[model samples]
Target: MSENIQKKIEDLREELHQHNYNYYTLDEPTISDFEFDLKLKELQELEKNHPEFYDSNSPTLRVGGEITKNFPTVQHQFRMYSLDNSYDFNDLEDWEKRVQKALNKPVEFVAELKYDGASISILYENGKLKEAVTRGDGFQGDEITPNVKTVSEIPMQLHGDFPDRFFIRGEIYLTRKNFDKINKRREEEGLDPFMNPRNTASGSLKIQDSAEVRKRGLSAVLYQYISSEFPAKTHWELLQKAKSWGFHISEQAKLCKTLDEVKAFITHWDTARHQLGFDIDGIVIKVNDLSQQRSLGYTAKSPRWAMAYKFKAEKVETELEKVTYQVGRTGAITPVANLKPVLLAGTVVKRASLHNEDIIKKLGLHEHDFVFVEKGGEIIPKIVGVNLDKRNPENPEIQYIKTCPECGTELVKIEDQAIHFCPNELHCPPQVVGRMIHYVSRKALNIENLGQETIEQLYREKLVENPADFYALKKEQLLPLERMAEKSAQNIISGIEKSKEIPFEKVLYGIGIKHVGETVAKKLAKNFESIDE
Candidate 1:
């Protein structure tokens, strides 16, 4: 009876894996959802009853109940370098010229959609999924193996010929349909809707619950295969091999023999991208020949053989309702345009940055004017231009504020700076709170649990005023604050304690000094032994 059960489990696992590949990778469902679910339920029941027949690569594992308290940081074997960006055909031509000049030969290209999502590096050993990591700083990233395993699009086991040990890098993205579904559920639950699919998908990977990660409906498209042994001679061929191995590859990916063909591919996708259920910000053009890629080599930050042609930012006409001023941590005053809510690039835009007085002047702002708002690089929303035809001549022109809105302090324009600054840096409320927030940020001391809201809450309660006061925080005092649980308070205290071991360079960066960035802080730390110097 036990032998019969083990055979049944193995057969079910293979059949489910094939069905998953067919539905997801091939875009063909061999069975209805109800039938699939029933089969899955039977297998799940059998597996639960017979623990001796457990298989790590079983389809049942995709449901994901594993909990990860902390994801361990692991160094990548091959450094995941970023691609150099090109805005126009001229830039692509220039890149092509440089590549040809270096190689002194004709070259072919592979054009693939640059998916706007979290970058992931997944390692497979002996045809089995071993580890998955994020593209943290190129050199190292957090190991999110359990979270990645939850993604049904990524095959847990290879089917065809593959390298003994290899790493496949790809983008993990949330489909537009799934994103909308999630937002709808969140809205019903009285929670703030996620800003975008890319951000939501990226954040899902870091979630402690593997079950939650599974529910996010994350998908991946493997683009690059890295290994010591060469499986194919060209990039396009590599993608084909990866697809045969049960990895999802983009069907839109095309091989271009010439730069003109590459341009045509980019031009086609620029408009047709809207039809895609997933978000793609641009096109990635790479030299097709593996030997040529290796010969072309890499620059300091990106691959010299490949280039990313970014599509122009999506622009939408919206009514500019009003203008607001914000004070930054450096006391720089920024003008913000409050707009009538308009959807652009899947996200609603209600406000956009005017950048400074110079940008405001360049745009020729007027009250109640219809303006062009675009997401700069598909992330930051900014007002690009004014729709003059729709602008009312009777409306008054918008002017930059002459004083700090937060403190009523007179603002002064610094020499060579475009934006006006509030000279009251020491006493400005925003600057003080911003500085404290910056001190515990990821690049700074990295005190966990000390988020912006918590800092603001502490400031409003009069429990803390500056970064120095964080060290004096007591568990008794924290427990009384809103939403402050005992474990959270203890975690914050522990994080604060751990931050003391951070390097002097990071400490210098955390101090919120004017013009002191991470690199500058590192340089200062190298020059001086202590802060006294």
Candidate 2:
């Protein structure tokens, strides 16, 4: 690389790093969108020219950030679990009968609308909110206490004389009013709106900035207390007591005495649930008696005493308009099936992923063919199959692309893997950007203030070409950037310096290796003599 080009790269990383900290951690911005873009563009061009020298911790790999090889295992006080789901009244009745058989007596049931949002465990100690954790893998969750305290519904202090240490299980959700308002504003600003209230609510709660949490209007309603010492006799009674402790309890919860009553309650909500302001994917039916709940116990993944009745999949038939290949950050090219717009599951279903070339060929999917689509897990909807009977006589067989559209590079298929990859590496701008992002992510380098946009900005401005270049940055270099001030530049430098002292495992994960993740990286770190080793 030319001396000037290397110097330019160093200057860019410093500026971008400062911008990332300001926007992501501080929730403040010093630069304009256009200026940031210019910086990111420059960094990407330089990396493309010198692919061999690119560093792993560059700020380009944020989206599609892969899972760490493993998370440090955290065992819970009581087993964290999921709920068994039922769809309609018949299924609900079946569950009720099963519960009756398990209890071997007259069993009273507690019915509540299962909130379609993030599940969290709020910890209270001596009448104060001590910690808030995500129900991550039903074991341990990220400690998001700072962000959780910003939600108004989450009481700072407990109302009742609850035990010194207790856990309240609740679904944190965004209100319909807040959801619509945010979407409307995004639309006005020409930004893609949030898909659903549940996703937005979850994203809002998990954001690093507590100030951002305040603006999102997130709310939580307590459903159950996972306390070992609570003296509550029944599930319904426990919920009622939790309400007295100032938790936002569900108002529609009903205490059912018979299987018939459970069926009736399920049926009532099936029709009336959408009337509520927030989204609810299903209803939960729990054994009312606390003692019975304890006796029935938990399975590997969920509680045996309770089950959730999920709504049926809503599907629609649409024309297979076009199939496009999207290269993921990891360089995997996934085939996305674009469809003629058709309404399904309260939203328009336009495109679905074909997963891989095998799936496309298996379905014999061709452009303009009619296909049935349904939202799986109420999230991504893909083409179930093509109507071969409706195939046009004039149109030809659809062949998958053999090379990446962006770089004209031959796609590589790893042994025993379905996904095709573009081998361009640093030459591919998107992948370069993706790698940079992964390097600076929260769990990796943990540079608190960096974000996706700033990474893109740094790439455009030619400020940083690789992760190692970040270490060579100077504060004076950043002051010339559009929004950067001396103070902000110094903060970025400080964060970058602090990140250098992080464990080698984090640096390894930040590099965006194909199969290596945090857990595997940690294992490697423990065994290896040095980072290079």
Candidate 3:
């Protein structure tokens, strides 16, 4: 009787995995929703009764109940290099010339959509999903296997011929329909809606509850196949093989035999990208021959063979209600344009960087002027120009502020510098808080528990002023603050204590000097034996 039950469980798991592959990866569902749910329910009951037949990759695990407090960082077996970008056809021609010169031969190219989503690397062993990691700093990333497993598009078990062990890199994204649905629910519940699909998808992978990740309705599309011995000779063939093995490879990927064909592919997609269900910022072009790619080699940062062609940024016009200033850590005052909320690209734009006083003057910005807003590189919002025809005639010309907004001190503009500086570096609230925040940043001391809010609280209560003051903090002092519990307060102290073991270069960078950046700090550390030197 037990043997019969075990066989039934195994059969159900296989059947459900096939149904998932058919629905998500193939885009062709063999079973109806009602029928699939009935089978899933049956499997859940069987699995619940027989603990001995538990399988980690079983389709039942798709509902996701695992809670991960901390995602452990793991090094990639192969370095995940970023692609060099090409904004125009001229740039692509130059890149092609360089590649041809290096290889000394003709090469076919593979053109794939540059999906604007979080990059992920997943490992498979013996046709079963093993681990999934994010693309962090190229060398290492956080392991979020349980959260990734909840994505139905990623198969737990391979169907066809598969490698014994290998890693496949791809993108994890949320569809446009789901993104709207999520934001609609959030708006109804009186909560702040997500800014964009890319950020929302990335944030979902780090959520503590796997069940919550499933609710986010995430999807995956595998593109690149990595292994010690590739199954195919060309990049295009490898993608085809991956698709056959139950991976959700993009059907839109094309192979171009010449530069003209590649250009045509870009032209077609440049307009058609808006029609896609998910967001894509550009097109990724790569040399098809695997051997030629190996011979071309790579630069320090990115592969020499692959290049990304970014689309022109979408621009929109809105009313510039007013201009505000922000104080940086170095006392530089940056002008910001507060605009009437307008939708640019996929996200809503409420404010844009005016950069400095020079930019405001160049735009001839005035009170209640209509201005053009666009994402600089599909990333940061910037005011490009003013719609002068729509400008109000009676409005006053925008003037640069002479006094520091926070400290009420006279501002100074250095010769040859476009920015106005707040000379009151010592007592300015923003500068002081910015310095402390910079000190505990990831690249510097890497203090985990201490965040921007807690630092502001510490400053408000007069408990700390400088980075050095963090070392002298007591548990009792932190406990008195709002939302500070016994465990959280101890964790903050422990984090500060661990920061003492940071390297000399990081310590130098954390000191918050005006001109000393990470690269300069490393050079200084190499020359000087100690901090005093």
Most accurate candidate by lDDT:
3
Question: Residue by residue across 1-533, what tens digits does model 1's lDDT show?
Answer: 88888899999988998898888788889999999999999999999999998878888889999999999999999999999999999999999999999999999999999998999999999888999999999999999999999999999978867888999999999998998888765533223368788999999999999998898899899999998778789999999999888999999999999999999999889988877998899999999999999998998999999999999878899999999998888888888899999988767889997879999888889999999988754334888888899888999998888888999999999789898999888779888888887888766898888887888899999888888899999889889999999999999999999999999998999888879998899999999979899
Off by over 4 Å in 3: 317-368, 375-384, 389-392, 396-533
Estimate the TM-score for candidate 1: 0.68
What is the Å distance of residue 291 in model 2 from its true position? Answer: 11
TM of each candidate vs. truth = 0.68, 0.59, 0.67
* Model 3: per-residue Cα lDDT at residue 530: 88
Error of 3 at 277 (Å): 1.6
TM-score of model 2 vs. true structure: 0.59
Model 2 C-alpha RMSD vs. true structure (Å) is: 15.2
Residue 62 lDDT, candidate 2, scale 0-100: 21
Model 3 sits at a Cα RMSD from the real structure of 10.9
Report the candidate with higher TM-score, 2 versus 3: 3
Where model 2 places Cα greater than 4 Å from the true spot, the runs are 1-85, 93-110, 116-221, 224-238, 255-280, 286-308, 387-393, 446-451, 457-464, 468-505, 520-533
